[model samples]
Target: MASFDKKPTFAGLKLRLMNSWMFVAFFIGFFLFWEYSVLWFDIPLYILTPPSLIIENGAADLPRLLDYTLVTGTEVIIGYVLAVVLALPLGLAIAFSTILKRTIYPFIVCIEMVPKIAFAPLFISWLGFGLLPKVIIVFLVCFFPIVLNAILAFNSLSEELTLFSRSTGAGIWRTFFKVRLPAALPQCFVGFKYAAINATVGAAIAEFIGSDEGLGFYIQIVTGNMRPDLAFAGIFFLTLLGLCLFGLVTLAERLLIPWHISVRRN
Candidate 1:
């Protein structure tokens, strides 16, 4: 396995900090552009409200947005958890057993090819206009990466190493526990990270189709009321949620597979 110590150099840290500062500066600059457009071009104010105005709306309506955020946040968490639980054992089974993989792989591929959004209404019909649909949607969006990535990782374990272990009289279970499982772990977390990222969008779409609350529902409500600024704020919150999940996955990957090349570089 590859190692990933970034040296934690002062210059590296400084450069990373500068990158973040640049991002913030760019964000502020966008708002400045909007402000200037409003003043200079005599454009429709609503079309290009300055960042301050947008934030004022967020500040004034945070309680409402926060309330909705809690609802959506809950759905994202629940749905992501469900994906992990279902994907883990299932992935292991598919990866470790050729028989199971052959039987299930085709079915999964077929389902994967279908756009899940097309069936959002079906989910609503079957699960009703509640948390169930949102959770199911999240799972549907996320489950594939988990399964596929796990299978790939499981297969990528060095066969020569396994043969050596077997020749040394290590039993199958012992070899798996000592070697294959650890080798596959980096990819397992990778799948989870990607799944969680997509799941946030899934949760929102499901909420849009049926639910009366959550971030998606909030976006729907605001857009209907001609409140694009509030909608953009909701979008901002949604991006934060997804990015936070991805960051957490990255952290977990670092912890679990510090030696894996994918995680070592800062």
Candidate 2:
């Protein structure tokens, strides 16, 4: 019998490298273009600083930026955790119970209808300029997506699957653990990913409304001082923070649902 194994070709190696590093290459190319475009256009620094200057300024002020990042990150973490802890159970309850669906669900919908940002000032007034208000904002932003997704995930079980589980003589808990939970996890992760994206926004907006520190406040202060480079630096860190949060949620999804079609495809 002939050996089936073949040596890797140069083209295959190059393709794999491109697939793995495409985003990094694009990021570097984009910033290089931005840097040169600003220099070529003679754009005023106050209007739009080049990426080079933004990096220089950010490096110089790394400690301060890190401090503000920590503050914002703290709020995001606390709020996200709280939202997940409460929302999942509540979602499950609402999915299973008609009473909750009729009563509490509508109330939640009404609350979610209001723009979460609008509540920042009220929370600040009530909770003061402390961390609690910012945490509350993050919680609100994360809560609805998770709860709504959880409800949808739990309800999405097919009638056939339900009958099959019943026929197997599985108890409620067994059915939930073996079938419902796994099936629902993929959709639940959709909410988690969305909530992760919003968590950063919620914290930053809350800080923007009323806070002495955080990347949002830093950006505002730098902008008022006509330091566009520093403002852009703040934005860069904020973007990094958001990416980190999103990455964590994605990692969790992959770990928990490795057998899922989405995870398998990835």
Best by lDDT: 2
Would you estimate the TM-scores of all the predictions?
0.90, 0.91
Model 2 TM? 0.91
230-262: candidate 2 lDDT, tens digit per residue? 999998889999999899998888678877778
For residues 127-222, could you state the per-residue lDDT of candidate 1 as single tens digits?
888888887788888888888888888888887887888888988899889988998898788789889789788988988888888889988988
Report the C-alpha displacement of residue 191, candidate 2, in angstroms.
0.7
Model 2 spans with C-alpha error above 4 angstroms: 1-13, 19-29
CA lDDT, candidate 1, residue 152: 82
Whole-model lDDT, model 2: 0.91
| Residues forming the 10-long window of minimal summed lDDT in candidate 1 | 1-10
Total clashes, candidate 1?
1
State how far residue 103 of model 1 sits from its true place (Å): 1.3
